[model samples]
Target: MRRDRIAAIVGIAESDIGVTPDKTVLQLQAQAAVRALTDAGLHTRDVQALFCAGAWTTWTNLMLAEYLGIQPIYTDSTNIGGSSFEAHVGHAVAGIQAGLFEVALIVYGSTQRSQRLRGKVPGEVSLTEQYEAPFGLPVPVGAYAMAAMRHMYEYGTRPEQLAEVAVAARQWAMQNPRAFARDPLSVEDVLASRMICEPLHLYDCCLVTDGGGAIVVTSERVARQCRHKPIWVLGHAETHTHHTLLSMPDVTSTGAAVTGPRAMAMAGIRHDDVDVAEIYDSFTITVIVTLEALGFCQQGEGGAFVSGGRIAPGGSFPMNTNGGGLSYCHPGMYGIFLLIEAALQLRGDAGMRQVPNAQIALVHGTGVQLSSSATVVLGRD
Candidate 1:
């Protein structure tokens, strides 16, 4: 049955990837949507399903449909923070399998940087704020700071190990013409940078930029007519361990532990089959924790696993080939870009940063302050 069912990515693109104050979020979303549809050799009228997420607009799904003049029979606007788009991929595949929709469009856009809109801070809605916010718990970076400290205390995960993740991302960024941060970086350089929160230097954080990206998913029947090679959705799974940092069962571990193995199993492959990985890197600690959970290494061995140029540009395991959120554009939710890059790698279209004959790619997205996670495995036909 798994072999009989198939959903493939037929098109993908990005719009206004860097700072663009002139473009509103909806404009960015529309731009990416039209471009992605064009990439798939499709028009707005061909889209039967739509999915979008962001605080850029209320009812983001409806706004995108209206802007594109599309009337979709199915729509999804689920907002799970950074992992929303990866979850969208899983949903779109299920939609195609169930005959709910033939062609689905997933779009995302955010002006968090050029427009200086960080959206609502996480508080007052969860137990974290009820008990943790009173103590002035700075969201995201601050929460990640706590995780970094804990990882160090538990796994002997040094600040230097954290720096390797950032350094590797920048190395890949230098090869990306669209990357936001392409400057040379090293562990020593990262260590020398100013510290925002304890143990997390400036380089340990992800970039802030304005960007919009989109991907078109369709059943194999429609994919056969697309302009580009179809990147099949081999398997995928989504999971969330907690809504807030305080509620997290373990800072050193994440939902990737559950989603990764489940997705890999569904894909019928081992970790070694993946030619590249596109794990979310909102923070350096995110990459380390996620890699460990995904079975890349033992629980506390992420430090050693990512070290010694293992995940670097020319390393054995290519990761974040589009520079990831660390050096690439991070317009609020970054999961969309992860999917875009994975599809590109599998299609053998990733210029400069392309992994040689990359056949299988793994994409993982971390949501909120490392509370939610989603893993999707993609392959070329």
Candidate 2:
């Protein structure tokens, strides 16, 4: 692939996040779409392509297109769990690069918190259910816990090292007013918190919150007309290994090991070039394992790398500046918020929580407990 920027994110927004009981999933999507389009200084009529995904409905893209009242030339609703939206960014970039569309809108929303739908098992009846569901492994958390256990046994990862991930996220959340659990958190607090699945505590797990987020992508020509500086989509890749934990080739590793390097190679950059990162923190172990897979540190060194507040607000490598799914709004699918916050930092619009001189941002998303991975390298010119 050519190293030139194929597409740029022009606008980003979040709609009524954190316990939005009054809003339906579609309403939340519409709100985010409108706000994002407004932020881009564009109108609904300008959206030439539409992309969306959610747990509420399978026909999310069709419904969102109708709701937004636009007949886009291109559409996609590729749902590969929480990393769906990050993959959507890659899809939009390809469409724009191929001259299929000029303006692409990606949106996501969920009411899992309001509907009391937490801990629900995967809806389909398949081999995944037959192999893992019979043991009553708590849908996603159990899978992550098993991975954490393997990481601990193999690398000697300690409880405090895992707790450090939660504490660091909370430290960043305290600075973000929109974060759901902004209360002060510490390593001791994480350790003391009730353990949901063995090894993974309540604090280590991500919050179940109602939220919506949006991003606007366009070609370099269209980006110049938008409201904010163009956050270029320099490189991207998505891949999945398994849907069930048992099928995963290595619980201690993820597909990120493949996607991360591929994305950076495509972007023509080095690991040191990333000024900021928005890594998916579905669980503390997810961050630890992913950091290693993404080549941020040597394999199994994730524990020490994230220790001593290394990824906190003022840390050498500022990450998840919007508090991440662990502290900020998760909304079931957290990939969209990763893009939203990355764009904010690249545009220099992330107040208080901004990473100073953040020129390049790397956004990574994990789906369904180490099942899928998507990495995007973004930068501002």
lDDT string for model 2 (160-248, tens) is 99999988899999999989989999899999999899899999999899999999999989998887889999999999998877789
Residue 332 lDDT in candidate 2: 90
lDDT of each: 0.90, 0.91
Q: Write the per-residue lDDT of candidate 1 for residues 137-247, one digit (tens) a residue.
A: 667888899999999999788999999999999999999998999889989999999989999999999988999999999999999999998899988999887875768
TM-score for each prediction?
0.97, 0.98
User: What's each prediction's clash count?
Assistant: 0, 0
What TM value does model 2 have?
0.98
**What residue pairs clash in candidate 1, if any at all?**
none
Off by over 4 Å in 2: 121-124
Best by TM-score: 2
Candidate 2 lDDT at 41 equals 95
Residue 48 in candidate 2, Cα distance off native in Å: 1.3
